[model samples]
Each structure stands twice: as C-alpha cells, then as structure tokens.
Target: PPGISMAEEARYGFGQPATEADIKAWNIDITPTGEGLPPGRGTVRQGAAVYSNKCAACHGPTGTEGPKDRLVGGHGSLATEHPVKTIGSYWPYATTLYDYIFRAMPFTAPQSLTADEVYSLVAWLLHQNGIIPATMVVDAQTLPNVTMPNRDGFVADPRPDVESRE
Candidate 1:
C-alpha cells in the first residue's frame, strides 16, 4: 500500500429518493390484459389525421414505404423466406403496441405523445394492417381484445427447469 494512498470515498449525493408520486407517475406499463392502459379513444378516421401529421414522414403515407420499419401489410408472409415482419404479421398483442408508442415513437421525440395520440396511432396502424375495420374505435378496453394474426404463432418453450403450471 506504499503507492496507493486511498482518498476518502467520494459520495456525489446528486439526487434524493423518489417519492411515491414520482414512482406512480413513471409506472406506465400496460399489460396484455390491458391493466395499465390509460383512458382514451381513437377512431380510424381520426387516426388517419394523426398519422399524416405525426407519422407519415417516417412511416410513409401508407405505412409501407417506410424509411423506418414497415408497419403495414405482410400478412401470411412470416413463414416465407423473405418474411416481412410487420405489426400485423408478428405482433401478438395490441396492448403492447400502445405501451410501445406511449414509451417511444414519432422518431423526433420519445415519450412525447399523449395517451389520445398514442391511441390514434394504434388505431391507424391496426387499420392499415387490416386487423381492424375503419369504423372501429380503439380504446383501452377494446385494444386488449384486438387479436393479432400471429397470436397463436408463438409457442411456449418447454424448459426442463421450468415446470408446467398446469
């Protein structure tokens, strides 16, 4: 320890403990069962407007010509060699779509979309993907029940260490 003169431990103490309100505000996770989905509604018509304003620049007018990840079509193509993994073709749950948009989207600003805006985006995306009709209104309650095409495509892994609950 001749050359190692240890200085006193440095404690920056930069921040205070998060209060309950802070924790609650940040807990915005939405489950597949739609547990944490906020109260908001969006129709396909309204979603079209929202998409044109907020999303078209990146995702394209049709959600297909994306400079980013493609969001529409690609149905029944997952098993093909050139599988176009899109939201309709790959996503298993719609609630997670809401969760994702709420958490990160629009490319320019993450977590900047309001619940209503997120809902509208979800509605537009789903409509483009042919999952829901144009007349359909997507809300927290109906969103969880909108079954994705690939919902049953995923099978549970049978691990030796994990016993089957059934």
Candidate 2:
C-alpha cells in the first residue's frame, strides 16, 4: 500500500468512472418482454450445429454433462425425491435464460457468441426441453412470446415480519 500514489489512491477511491458510451457498449440487458433484445434469429436445427461447434465440449452432446454443467432436459424432476433442476423446468423466465446464456455460457469462453448464435442456442435448448417446436426460430420478436410453464410458480418474497418487526 506504501507504493500506491495519492492520485492513484484518489482514483481508486472515486471508484470506476464509466461513460454513457461505455455503458451502452457493455449493457446487454434483455427484459422479459424482449426489450433490449438484439436483431437476429436462429432455428433449433441451426442451434444444434452451433452447439456442436461452440458448446458441446463443455455442456455435453445432449446437454447432460460428464464433467461440465448440464444445459437441458431435466423436466419434471424437480418435484421428485431426487431432483435435477435444469433450464427446462427450473427457470422461470425464458428471457432470463437468453440473457444469461448470451452473457455467460460455454464456461471457459463467455460472451463469445453473436446475437444470432445466442438465439440459436436458446431455440435449441427450448426445443430440447419440449417448451418450443424444433422449427421455431428464436428472435427478439418471438423470444419473449414463448410462455414458460413455470412462469407463475415462483412467489415474491414476503419478508414483512423480518424487516418491519425487527
């Protein structure tokens, strides 16, 4: 800490200074209504190709991994005695799925996919989960339209006693 200069310390204390342009460049937030979704489309079939080329090694061929994270097909298992929560059944919002995968997926390499490639991957995963048809193309227009089965399953946290009473 002695080597740290006053100016450097001041800059650090000021925290990260980000510009609007910088924020715009890195801001990739996608809403549940498809707001901020990029312009692109990908079919389930195309996604299979993309996955094999970009995601298969880490996520496994069928999305069930031997060593890495599993990305698909664990529906109806969450309520069972032994549950394996997956994107198929556990995820409440499809848009969140797309946003998450687009931002951080493939483990080692994150944010390495184009908008179209992300859409393709989403389509593939949704199709694998039986949430969407294989022929469906996931895009900004349609991605938000797909109704997730567990959309209403989660309840808002009611912590009135803990916060108010405490």
Candidate 3:
C-alpha cells in the first residue's frame, strides 16, 4: 500500500478493448465438434511434404520415429503397463489434434502453421497410426469425424476440480 497509487488504478479503466481482429487472432481454439475451425484443408500426401520440411526434424521421418513425443502407433498399448499415450493412442477427438497443432507445435515456432498445414499434420499423424488413409485430406468436416482409438476410454470426472491452493 505504501508504494501503490490511485493513478495505477485509474489506468486500468483507460486501456482500449481488444479489436475484432485481435480477438480473432488470439481466439484460435478448435473444439472436439470441429467448432472454431478455420477454413483450410490438408492431405496426408501434402502433409508428408510439410512434415518433412517443418516437422520431421523433431518428430522424425514418420511421426512415430521422432525423438519428441511419438505421434503415431501404440494403438493398443494404453492398457499395458508401459502405455505410449500418443495422439493416436490417447487422443479422444481428432479436432483436438488440430487444436493442439494450431495452438502449439513444431517446437521452434508456436502458432506458426497455417490452418491447412495443421490439417495436413493431423492427417499424416492419423495415417501413421492407421486411423485414417494416407490419402485422406483433413478439413473441418472430416477432421472432427476422425475419432481416435481411446475416445471411449476416458471417463469424465465431475468433481470439485478447482485449482488447489498448493
């Protein structure tokens, strides 16, 4: 209270609200139902090229062989003691994959890939995991429909899930 001032408080009311473009740019969240999906498309074939140029360095030639968290295979290993919870093995919804890549991916630059590029990556990852055909093109409509292997495995927990004070 000694160092605080009323001027600081007044400044809080002086700031301008976020513009429409600014709101849209920051509100890039995609839903499991494929809501909020940007208009774009990417095929597993084109994703192959995108992945090679932008993703392979971290995720390896294929999504599975990468040094980072593997994005392919491990389809039936969830119940095993050593479960590999990859995008295919553990992800519940396909659009969630798109959301993740669009929000944070490529390790080098976050939120850098275009909607189409992210779509391609999702397709290739799904293809590598045998969830979809290699020629499949992931767009808003098809992406939300590509269910993952563990879609029904996760049980919703309705609880007092507020953040702990710790």
TM-scores of all candidate predictions against the true structure: 0.82, 0.80, 0.82
lDDT of 1 by residue, 1-166 (tens): 2553345235554688899999888998999999988888988888899889988999899999988989998888988899998898999998989998878887788789888888888998998899999988889889999999999888888667766796
Q: How well is each residue in 90-161 modelled by candidate 2, as lDDT tens digits?
A: 888899978998888766788888988899999998988889998898898998999987787687788664
Q: Per-residue alpha-carbon lDDT of model 3 for 34-141, expressed as tens digits?
A: 899889899988888888998888887877776887888787898899998888889888888888887888777989998889988888888888899977878988
lDDT of 2 at 119: 94
Estimate candidate 3's alpha-carbon lDDT, on a 0 to 1 scale: 0.85
Question: What TM-score does candidate 2 get on C-alpha atoms?
Answer: 0.80
In candidate 2, list every pair of residues with a backbone clash.
Answer: none
For candidate 1, which ten residues in a row score worst on lDDT?
A: 1-10
Candidate 3: residue 136 Cα off by (Å): 1.9
lDDT of 2: 0.85
Q: Which is better, 2 or 3, measured by TM-score?
A: 3
- Superposed by TM-score, candidate 3 places the C-alpha of residue 89 at a distance from the truth, in angstroms, of 0.9
Sort every candidate by lDDT, greatest first. Answer: 1, 3, 2
Model 3: residues with Cα > 4 Å off, grouped in runs: 1-17, 158-166
